[model samples]
Target: MPRFSIVVPVYQVQGYLRACLESVLDQSYGDFELIVVDDCSPDGSPAILDEFAARDERVVPVHLPANGGIGPARNHGVRLARGEYLLFLDSDDSYTPGTLRAIAERIDATGRPDVVLFDYARTHWYGAVKRNRDAEVFGAAGAEVFTVAERPELLDLFTVVWNKAYRLDFFREGGFAFPTGFYEDAVVVYQTLWTARTITLVDRVCVYYRQRRRGNALRTPSREHFEVFAQYERLFRFIEERPELARWRGFLYDHMADHYLFILRQRDRVPPSSRPEFHRRAARDLRAHRPSGHRLGAHIPRTSFTLLSRAPYALYALHRVAAVKRAGLRRRHRVWRRRLRKVLLALHGRLVLRRALDPRLAVYSAFSHRGVLGDPAAIHRKAQEIAPHIRSVWVVGKDHVDALPPGVEHVLPGSRAYRRVTARATYLINNVNWANDLVKREGAVHIHTHQGTPLKSMGADLLKYPGARRGFSVPKMLRRADRWDYSLVANPHSELVWDRAYPCGFVSVRSGSPRNDCLVRPEPGRRESVRQRLGVPDDSTLILYAPTHRDHRQGGYAPTCDLERLVAGLPGDHVLAVRLHPSLARHHERGLGLRDLAERGLVLDVTDEPEVADLLLASDALITDYSSLMFDYAHLDRPVVLHTYDWDTYLAARGTYFDVTERPPGHVTRDEDELARLFASGAWCDEESTRLRSAFRARFGGYDDGRAAERVVRTLMLGEDMAAVPVVPAPGAPSDVLTRS
Candidate 1:
């Protein structure tokens, strides 16, 4: 007789269903009945279950006539289960190696209790890749303590059913059945966990949740969260009807607070016209349904004429706006410093003292000839690859040595710095805007790897080096641009974009860019490595919040949020880490607002680190504002969030090179709460993400594969031609190679 009936409910996980079933089938611990239920999935899920049943007598495939959500579907499967214990597994989420085996061992090791909970993990949008250890993007996190109502003040437990396995008797005792539609599982788990006789919790992750998928169920913002009171009224009515559980009012009140806060947050997401009604309905629901008198709405709503006397929702809304504005003003300096410093560093870099931890790169460019400049990660990585090959390569700038990666000996640049470096180097490649006349002066083959996308030339650099020699009417400008002897391009995509953008800049084309091309390489198990390193529980959804700088250069765009919406809507196990651009590095520090997010222990600021990819790799999804980094995150195929509050101003100032929101990389939120709601919906590896990523990647050069640097270097080193480079990625990224010259 089977000891456990592992209930595997299937919906639409065709791409991953095979892997999910295989993990269960491959479990080292046998003796468990495999109850695979197909909830009328249109995909290949039914076929996989049929195959499983045909092969193994222990496998029982339960088919539902029509599509019922997980609750009803699982209940149907449960009726057929014959084991002593019930283990629930979502069809889309997979079991890791030795997961079921581990659970079986735990049961055997300790006499099985009424409840057994194991952990799960998330996969990033990008294929797993190695990451800088310090970024704190993904790693092992501690397992939540889920013991029987220990602390009096502690609220009702967040009931995640799939994580736990229960004795069949436990279900029979409480007579558990799912509540029906959306969030029904939550209702079942709440009563079930509270009723459990004994429970066991383990930190190891067994399930691998696919994250940031474009169209997941939870992505839709529900009216349920907005109509907070009505839902709670029903829940409370049920609670009151069960006078047997009368003592749990305190716990239920806390739950109600959570509901109110959740709806409060989404006040911005719902239609503005509907908000007054949404609020009025919410107020009525809260007023009608109560555990007794702490009437939350009454305290703030009944008598309100003063500034603070307004409705609590309105008061908090205004407070949030004020707080956001105050924070923007406070962090304005750091934001200003972050933005303004880049230009200054490009100009005065050769003459200033380098800070101890300078992330700036001293790249050589063909377009801007005056000062030493930096562009993208490609130049840094390529230089590293070829650094050993070339001896005495001159490094010119005030802090040039700080930027150099451990090996090369350096020379600083002055007005004559170019002459000094040019004299000593084997090749003075134009990685940034620093000019070089290798074809004219010293027989140096100057590789022109221009920084930025091809297509349009709105900048002075584009006007100067319009790619192939159109020969400028102005002698000085022509001489400076002609300093580039050879140019590089990523592929036919970059080839075409640059053709129109740089009509005269191209001397010759090579298949390289040390700066932007390294993203294409295969990432060798970096996700797991970083996940293990970060100490994140294998099951937590690692989210990265990456917002770009505003073009107007002032006024931090304030976005709206719905905390209750996320808490109520998102899978309870996920975690969000917000990493704003370095340009806004000071924003967090300037106000107690964002810093307090750390107090809640959700957001992480990674700008202090040298590289952003480490954080990217660690994250399962990327939540961002309007920034080019979205493209970098896109390569990972992770979920991307565009939290653009000031889209009007941003478009007016710096129009996106392409229509960014057409296919929409991920959900676009005008408010922080909605953005959070979208972030709560993890990464995707299915059809939806496939379509979004394919369309988005088309606009930029296809260099997201971690190996972009390798391709670019191989192209340039063998004297191949390169067109204009893709927009520079973050610093300290993988090495870019221009291969197979």
Candidate 2:
């Protein structure tokens, strides 16, 4: 018998069937059998199945004579399954790579549990992937193996059959089968969970549940959704049959009501004409399932339950309409308020622009008003110290207000104060271009302290790669560049690139990076303090992995390096610090599983750490892929390993300034194996790596002499002449000891 049997019930999923089949067939663990059940599919799924079966003997195609539904099709596959474990997969969904191996390992490690539940991510058609919100439930199980009685919260997970692997003997002994209907899997999922002797969980994401934009049976409006009542009815009957499961009646009732109400509220699911009848059926079911002395859960509003149980459908309909209207009114009021605020701000800004510039006032922003970060923040701090008369005000987004340091004055991006400051401030500083609506006054000084040296094509250079351009307007970009009085360049290469990319009249000041000044002369004990906070040992080899954002995969985080594989392959003392690009950090945290890994002491997720320079100082070496942090990290003179896994793809999709592979700062490895080997063999920080890093540094590491911020402060804010500004120290000079004279 095979170790596992994957049953897939196919209907009209022709678009996704091939990927589903191949996901299973291409698994590293080859002991599983693929049972593709054709539920009278009208599409070309049968032909695809036949094609796969002809090539692979592991495929067992079962064609139904007539359409019985997904439940019956799965039952037929189970009857033929000879594997020790039975797994169900939806034809539209797919298993992630190494899913079966991970499951098999978890099963063995947990002593062959009767049921194994795993996490899944919702893969959208628009290239965005979000992990299940309740994924933490897997880790909250509190043990490797446990029963439902020990952790009933497992029932809180979505009622789905595909995210689990069931021992065939245990399933057959329990006589479990999916009920036929719209929610066929609900009864089966609850039954297996409630009855299983031993249940375990795999915290990793094993499945990519494709959320289709259309053609989804559940999302379609129809009376078939009433099958939910029948499914819950079966679930309650199962509880009735076994009096021992009577304690879970209240919880099950709550689940059924929540599910019913959710379906009723969704605009696309229950039609307006059928809502009254749907509510009537739901009320009847809620009354029928109410256990003796059972009270509704805290999350379920008591008033909602009372209305569903007692109020007439007409009354309930009136209540729902009123609730929706109130919500709509609230939304409209908020929109009106925002519009009025914008109008007022615009008027205030226009009035303020007529007055003389506030020579002592300076406005700072970074990352397009993301927060007070990068060069702008560094410059702001220095101005506060040396040019105390200059009042610094930072413009940040409302969501990122907390990113501001204590006692720092800030205004929201679109506020009246923000507009007034933009209009009146004599010195305006930003790492990125201000909003498109920004107007440059005659006498105002606009300093563009760029975020980093460009490794990829930027500005007008992006005109060649339309994908990289991503709706970039060259005319508007140059207009913003035209506002610049001075452009801060870290090195000669940056000055040349900035001149070509942004054709502006601004003088290119080779003033180095104010941000890297922290790297050159970090506060004493900062490195150790940061390491301690991150739980990294002083003796460990801290490898900071910071990959740049890919222009092709916008709003997505798809790193080519398998983080788990890389971390597992490394020595126990070696800790990996993962710092995601700011753009992808918030959206991809759950998908990356960084929190879980950090808790396990495997890797440090320093993505949210306000200062990137602090992370550089805390790490022993850096691992990057085309991120300009590699250039900044070179200032430390540390070993840098280039993980160029998708170099060719990135180069084609988003044109780079030069081929990094040809002249990398350190050893360049294209695969995780090669990357792991470099660290294991001590080649990551060897003589050749140092030699390459020295050459790369000489080219890109000039101008940052631990006093870039001081120089900028003296020149712009303090009104010091360029010649009078502190001269950059010579190469190999003691940067840490070079204090203000």
Candidate 3:
């Protein structure tokens, strides 16, 4: 008998099957029988499994006669296994290198436990990887073997069969089998955990839990997702049979409540047409399952739980809006309090101040929060480096206080400390405006390091796009813009745009965007270091698809381009890196299908990445649609393809200042077909594209000479005068003169 039986139930995962098999077959610990159960897969997966089985004797292919679900396939694979331990794997996901070896080593060290639960990295298509959510539970469980009673927090670990290995005899003795249907593994995994006399936890990430582009039961929500209730019911019945496990009732109830609440929140998952029926089912399930006289723990919001438990339909229909409004009102109330505090600080400033502004005090806010890593962050770092005597205090939200970097003093947005710092700070730097009521005191300077190269119209232009500016007050915005002591710009076009957009009296600092300084002139090893951190092959033709957000959509800018088709059409040498606009990141769950494509190695989801510059440095080409990233990537002089599938709708909603076709930096592809044709023909970058890039650079890449941050620091932060700084043209910039309006 083999030491381990790795059971991978394959369905329609032909594209990813090879990678999954290779990951298992190439394991460092070779004493394992690979069970590939082809569950009557409609695709070419059966043929692929046969080929793999032929190639390696270890690969045992089980061709199911009918289309049974994953639960049945796994059960069949287990019964056919001849191994001491059993492990389940999904066809779309892969094991990390040496995972089996590591597990074996841990098992041997621990004297063989009944079950071993490990951690995994949730990988997205755009190369971004999220560590397991319940990593802390593993940390708390440690390496030592213990029962569920000893480490009850083990229940918190994600109930996924793929992330663990089970002792075959122990599992069989427990009479645990995967229940057929959605969330089939939930019942068995829970039972196995509680039934095991000795369970061990390993902190290592042994698997790449794929967030697939499509066809995942969890992602494709339906009434079937409600099957989780039945799975839990089976688990509860088993728990009630075991008299010793009675103490777990409250915890189990809380988990059930959380599961139902999760389903209720995913509004799209519950079809609008079937919502009434869905809510009724959810309400009935919660009522039937929830143990009477059980009080929810502090971790579970009492109000939301009570609402969900009693009237799931009403809670689902109305609670979100009411909750949002309540939260918004509370935020506004805090903002008003902060404004009042600033007013009081201003009054005290006039009465007791010897000097109007304190030169040593510099206040910074990046995206109007206490982040030490954006344009304002670059300015702060430069300021401290250039002038050590200057004390910098960052204004952050209450939640970000602990996340603030050491040695940097930070004040909560509305706290007295913030008011005091704002009142005295001579140099005020931010990517966006400060509080509305806080006027810029005389003698103090405000430097607006505008976040990115604006593609969509901003400031005054927002008034034209009603969808973009529903509640915005132009007069109030201009009033805030009126206080700008200086404004930073990447190019002369932006200088003109800012002047027209704000129409303020501030001097347009012909300095490049401080944020792009790292991209334009990266340090010697910065590019390699960042690429290493992102975990992409150095030789791969890195193509970045960084799209902007949409104004008309409530879920922000979702991808219109078919990512799976685009990935399939791309050259074998190429790897696409994806970065969604920040607004889109807020609503990424709506774009989970894109994640499925990521799982197939067709794209890398770098949307969660905080910095776009790192991805830019690693990429050789860019794919986008009306994003300011086009302007940033133009600085790299790389080939960019415009995937403007929703161009007409986008134009009518959030109009751009200039037509992209009129002076596009590279080729434009309206849809996936056009994109595929370009890649197939090897016309991604040509002479015409290069020429357009030169012209585009000449128009927008004037001031980004890698020294914008230094200039901002020397002049604004250190109180120096460098107004005559020359704005040199890029290396291949055209002689065509475009006047700086």
Winning candidate number (TM-score): 2
Candidate with better TM-score, 1 vs 2 = 2
- List model 1 lDDT by residue over 1-741, tens digit each: 687888887887887778777878887667788888888889888998898899888889888889877778888867887788888877766666556655665666557777776555455456331112221211224323334554222123334577678888778676777655556655666666566656555445566656645646544555534533443554565667777666665566556655544544453345555555655665555455455655443333232212222365576557657866877987997889878976664545433322221112232422233222323345545556654343334444553346545654445554445444453343455655343332234444555566534422223333443332133333454455555555565444454454444345445343433333323442577667766765567888776666655434433333324333443455767766666555454441212224334433445545544446667777877666566566555666666666667766655555544556565676666765665555445433345656776666664444433444544444444334433343333333224423221
lDDT-wise, the better of 2 and 3 is 2
TM-score of each: 0.42, 0.83, 0.61
299: Cα error in model 3, Å: 7.2
Clashes of 2: 0
User: At residue 211, what lDDT does model 2 achieve?
Assistant: 92
Clashes of each: 98, 0, 14
lDDT of 3 by residue, 1-741 (tens): 899999999999999999999999998689999999999999999999999999999999999999889998999998988899999999999987657876887789888999998878787866556667666576562539888888877777777899889999998888788878888877877888878888887666788888876677776757777677678888789988998877887788788778777776676466667666756766776687667787777777777776765765655568867987888999999999989977887777565345467888899997668367678887777777878798999998875667677887898886767767887888899888888856578898999888777778899888888997766788898899888889888776777788899888888776678888887888688778877887777887888887777777654644477666777777888887878776555343322344444544567888867667788888899988898888888888889888888888888898888888678989998878998888777788988889888888777786888878888887666656665344455444434322232
Instruction: Please tell me which model should have the higher lDDT, number 1 or number 2.
Output: 2
Using TM-score, rank the candidates from best to worst: 2, 3, 1
Across 562-592, the per-residue lDDT of candidate 2 in tens digits comes to 7777888787788899988888755534443
lDDT of each: 0.55, 0.86, 0.79
| Positional deviation of residue 452's Cα in model 2 after best superposition, in angstroms | 1.2
- Once fitted onto the true fold, the runs of candidate 1 whose alpha carbons sit more than 4 angstroms away are 128-146, 151-159, 221-248, 263-278, 289-334, 337-741
The CA lDDT at 84 in model 3 is: 92
Candidate 2, residue 368: lDDT = 77
